[model samples]
Target chain A: MEILNLEGTEDTPKIILDKKNGIFEISGRSLPEDSAEFYRPVLEWIEKYSSDSNPSTEFVFKLEYFNTASSKLILDVLSALEDIKGMKILWYFHEDDEDMEEAGQEFSELVEIPFEFKTY
Target chain B: MNFIYDLHRTMMSQKLILVFQGDFTQESTKSILSMAERNLDSSGEESSIKRKVFNVMVEALQNIVKHSDELVDGQVRSHAAIFLIGKEANRYSIMTGNPIRKENVVKLKGALDRINGLDKDGLKDLYKEIIKNTTISDKGGAGLGFVDMARKSGEKLEFEFPEMNEEYCFFCLKVNVPRDNE
Candidate 1:
């Protein structure tokens, strides 16, 4: 498995997926214009990772802000992760932003996989 | 001409305004929104104000990217549109306008009508419902963006569809944000 790294932008975020450590992190603002384009590779990588089966895969999402399109993509990412065995996802939300916290909780409810929400 | 000038002056007096014309792709929208964020951050504005401007700007620009009628080289472009942000007394106002296809007017009307009918609580429920039921469309028109915008703005979303031609119309939306002092 190979790692994926993308720099964060004013409207996007930095994505660091470390295949060696089995730790995937997406952090920063994410309002990508072509969210499909921006997220396609990450989703594909996760799909590939799911099949290969790491002992334990930890996914981290630390987003300051994201638009509606990005929100949908996030859901897609979570759903993809849910299919993988031994996958653990941790969603970090800013303490000051109730909206973001609620969004994480909402996603937890929708997906069957357990999602741990942590405030930073 | 004088009336136009007066209207411009009046708008200027309200708050900061940024307008975009031509192609408004995802990259361009990201740039514009980032610029706004940078400006607000440098100015040391209140978080509430910053969030309000950010939410409204995102919603308006995304709408343009998804729905604008004019296309340039196969890409959707903003046609005769304006985006304005103004602070009046203690409140901020965000407004946007763009040309729309006549065929899409009915759907746009339905979207806005559903948005307007919802109160904050109702909008929240609607957003959750839509998010759960609607498949993520390529064009980003799950109708949840408008609902989220309205809920965040804490203001009634206002819109208009003026007849422009046999095939197109002008659609406009205005949302207000109350300043912290208010």
Candidate 2:
């Protein structure tokens, strides 16, 4: 299986998708200028990963900040995992970051994936 | 000569903390966010309020980059825009202005008016509906920025479209985020 790892930048998030070690995570600021273009490969990878099997997948979204355009792309990322049966999401937010917490709650409500929110 | 001092007096009178006027690009947007983040951090702003302001700032700045008239007369204009942040006793006001095609003004105005008319629940529903249905444009816009800004700031978006010329107009938007949580 091919692993995907992208370093976080000043405006974009770091993404890691490794089935071998069972680590699927996206973290940091996500205000990329071209969000759709930025997330295309990530979506494609997730699509391919869905075809193959994993007993269980734990995806983490520990985003500190994301623009509205990135919000739609994030939703697309979640939707791409709809076919995976044993999918769980771990969302992390800062202690006083109500907006991030609410963002997690909203996403949990939108998708079928179960989410466990962690406060840092 | 004295115009610089006059401009400073005006900024001070308005309680303006930061102002940027130039062609807004992705690089400039990143710089603006970083500078504003530092300003808020130094002011001892609460985490929640700072996040709201930051979110609104991103949307406002990106809005300029995505919608402004970068092309005019088959030539690429500068995408010149202005951004301002004013610190007040009760709230932080974010304002942005950019040139837009005159023909597109009506549609943009209608969208803003609809957003202003909605309450909290209404805005939330609109946001959810858009995210569920709309496709991100090639320019990476989902038309969700204004709605997100309204929801985050918990205030009606103030706007205007003053005529700049026959084919273009100046689009201005202002959003105020309360300093203290209500």
Candidate 3:
């Protein structure tokens, strides 16, 4: 499968999904008006990636801000990865951003994926 | 008109940092967020406070864009809503107003009241429960906006629903983020 790379906009996040090079990260702002539409291809890509085998998959999410709508889509993204073996998530938050940290904690609780929270 | 100057005086007197009253689109909402962001940046507020204010603003503006009822009455256009930010001595208050169908008032009020009734932990639990059980609606809402706003502000959400007409009511919501420890 081809890489699903997207440039970040003012209201959307940058997405990089590469299974061959072992790069899977979603970063920056994520407050898109139509979050489901923006993330549709992402979910599709993840579903396809799950079928192929990887020794271990580490996904990174370094979001600066995301609205409530994006939160639901984000949960969907995490839940989609629940079935993958040897999958882990790295969630990053700013030191001063309790809300972002709490958001990561909440997502971790709602999904079976192992999440390691990191601060910058 | 003199009323224009009068309105300006009122805004100045109230210490309004920003005020927008017009039709809301996704594009317009993005612009509004960026403009408010710049204002907050230049205000020299702490990053934590700014983040809370910005988060609440995103939820408030997007709610208007998604759920505001169309006013078919004369002069009022569809998707029309109002957003205002006021800088007080120790807090920043974000306010929004939009038309909603009269029929939805009771349900919306119940949601807000329930949120207000919860403590911090209760709000957190409610947020988690809703996110776990609810699917994203076609409108892209998971019924989490009010709870998220309340959680971030660490304060009660203030609101009013004034009758706009026989069929609609203007829903007004206000959330305040403290600038200094109280």
Candidate 4:
């Protein structure tokens, strides 16, 4: 279980998945042209990580902006994380951005996993 | 006879105008945006104007990419569209048009109307609220893009939904950026 780090771009966001430390972070803008292609590897890594180790994963999502497609992909990631036991996901959002906070709540509602929302 | 001369005079007095017709997908929009950016940079335009132009362009391009209905080659290729960027006196205007479904016209019109009605402070509040409340729609109706454009331009967003057919309509949006200070 290694780590995955991607630099943020104007159209995409930085993704950090540290499997070793059981920390996952996605931050910045995410308006990718092809959401599926951009998120496939991240999804696959999460799937593999959940299956291999029952690590106490801490998922952090700090998105300034993301499109509709990216929203769906984020849901997929949340669902995958739910599959793993003893996983703790902390969804962080800016204090001013109630929309993102509500989005986290929505995702939490859909998943059976223990998801917490923290405002910064 | 006089009308023709007036038209010619108007054309001569107007700045360069370029119209892009068709469905502006992500790829094509990206190309056009990059072109606009480069052209503006080379023209030694003021940074403020450049930024406003880029912001308005991005918002308009994103709208077309996500919402336009008419498609070519079995995919929406920015056809049935008209994009115009030109200067009228000291103001720069960027306008984009696309064929929209009749079902979407009312909603889009309402959105634009609301956007146009807001002042700068109102728009800022609306943007903050929209960004915090609006659910990310599956088909690109978060409504933040328009607000962003309004904020960037420091001007009201103008739009029209003209009838095209029973099932579709022509949607046009115009954003203005004044260059007098620059």
If candidate 4 were superposed on the true structure by all CA atoms, what would the RMSD be? 7.3
lDDT of 3 by residue, B1-182 (tens): 99999999999999898999887888888888889889988878789998999999999988888877456676666446899999998999999999888988999999999999999999999999998888888787878999999998999999999998798888999999989843
Candidate 3 chain A lDDT trough over 10 residues, lowest sum? A46-55
Residue B3, candidate 3: C-alpha displacement in angstroms: 1.0
Residue pairs in collision within model 3: none
Tell me, per candidate, how large a share of the native contacts it keeps. 0.28, 0.81, 0.83, 0.06
Ten-residue stretch with the least lDDT total in model 3 chain B: B69-78
DockQ-based CAPRI category assigned to the predicted complex of candidate 2: high
DockQ of each: 0.47, 0.86, 0.85, 0.10
Model 2 CA lDDT for position A44: 91
Off by more than 4 A, model 4: A7-10, A13-30, A34-120, B1-14, B70-78
If both were scored by DockQ, which would come out higher, candidate 1 or candidate 3?
A: 3
Question: For residues A1-120, could you state the per-residue lDDT of candidate 3 as single tens digits?
Answer: 789999998899999999999999999999897889999999999999999948899999999999988999999999999999999999999998888998999999999989999998
Q: Candidate 1: where are CA atoms >4 Å away?
A: B1-8, B13-16, B70-77, B138-142
Better by DockQ, candidate 4 or 1: 1
Report lDDT (CA) for all predictions: 0.78, 0.90, 0.90, 0.73
Q: Which numbered prediction scores highest in DockQ against the true structure?
A: 2
